[model samples]
Target: MTEFQAKEMEEQEEQIENEAEDNKEAEDSAPAEEQTGQSEVNEETLRNKEEEIKKLQEEQDELKNRLLRVQADYENYKRRTNEEKIKERKFRAQSLVEEILPVLDNFKRALDVQIESEEAKSLKQGMDMVYRQLTDAMEKEGVKEIEAVGKPFDPHLHQAVMQVENDEYEPNTVVEVLQAGYSLNDRVVRPAMVKVNS
Candidate 1:
């Protein structure tokens, strides 16, 4: 071969090698950039998912707390209703007893009247028997008369209609019971009308 022709061939070969190396480097760097971009997208997606999970958990906890509060309120209402029912059952006979009190007082007044004849005496005996039966029934139903005469005056059991300056009784003492008081189950149905020593 001629010298000039050889030199031209060598230059062509060198240019071809340079082009190949540039293509190889561009291919390698393209994959690295693509990987970096993919990783950034993945990180963004993960952060979004975490935030969504946190919000959902918070909402679930709030709903659970509301459910617990409702259950507690329902339980309290049930307990209160049960207590009211028990109290109603305990005081069931209060109204009937109150209605019978006036009748009992009338019977007591009739028994206190003096009798002069045999027929009147017989009627008095009959009334006395009826009164005794009524009192026995009341006693069975937890009714009791409050002992106010000579007892220490208590506002809960006694209603003082008059105060007396009596030397025979101590201060704040119940000297006499004008009208009888009654109780049922240790609860005052009616307070005794009384005279108190001041």
Candidate 2:
């Protein structure tokens, strides 16, 4: 144990302490670096999740829009079908009324014939009531008679059987209704057989 030996031993101890401190610092910095890397990974994962959510929202919106369009189309289809049903019902009624029109005309002709006997007159009156009831039922179903006599003649509504020179009516006016015209729902079912003024 001389003084030179003691000084060399102290220098060796100081070198070992410095080496331990450096190792401790390296260990601390490694964890901090690891934490930074983990944070970056977490941020990337969060961004991916946000992107996925955005795509899903856009898909949901598209689906909702499509649903609304389909709903609207279905509603329009229902409305059109209902309208067609009403038109079909009107057409059916009109056809039946048209078939019965000849019978009504025959009844009118029979009533017009002169009858003097009491029993025949009574029968005529009963037939007239029946005709009126039939006409009333037809009217309720939107069946109507076309007014031809004394009115301005239209080729669409009247069929001209003949033309006559007359001062009482203007030219092309209907002077006589030889056969009754009929309409259903404002549409002509049968045109009036008419004599028009020349």
Candidate 3:
């Protein structure tokens, strides 16, 4: 071959070798860029999952709080209903006891009259037995007599029928009980008629 043609062939071979090296560098850098992109995608997926977990936890807490509130309200309602029922029962018993007070007063008058007579001894005994039965029934129903005689007079339990001047006891004291007062379960059913010492 000629000298000029041989030199031209050598220069062409050098240019081809430089182009092959550049292509290999580009191929290696492409894999690095793809790895960086994959890492970013994984980070984004983790962040989304964390946010979802946080929201679920908040919702669970709210539901628990609501459940506790409902339970407390139910307990309060039960307590109130039980109290109302007890009050209703007490009121009913008090009303029934008040209705029988007049009969008890009549029995007291009859017993007083019978105890004053000697000829009516047998009749007095029968009347006394009846009085005992009535009083026993009243006691079973939580009825009690208020102490009036010789006690300090109270307008709430005693009605002053008359006032008298007396040196035997303190002034404003109850000296005589004309009609006995009664209470049912600590509530006054009837006020006593009494004489107060002034």
lDDT of 3 by residue, 88-176 (tens): 76656687778888888888776675245576888888888988888888788788999898899999999999999989989999999
Clashing pairs in 3: none
Residue 153 in model 3: lDDT: 93
Q: Please, what are the lDDT tens digits per residue for candidate 2 over residues 54-168?
A: 9667766965786697689679979999999988987878768889889877877878899999999999999989989988998898888899988999998999999999999
> How much lDDT does each candidate structure score?
0.85, 0.83, 0.80
lDDT of 1 by residue, 65-93 (tens): 86697689679979999999988776677
lDDT of 3 at 97: 79
Among all windows of ten consecutive residues in candidate 3, which has the lowest summed lDDT? Answer: 110-119
Return the TM-score for each candidate structure.
Answer: 0.70, 0.66, 0.62
lDDT of 2: 0.83
Best by TM-score: 1
What is the lDDT, from 0 to 100, of the residue 190 in candidate 2?
A: 92
Error of 2 at 95 (Å): 2.5
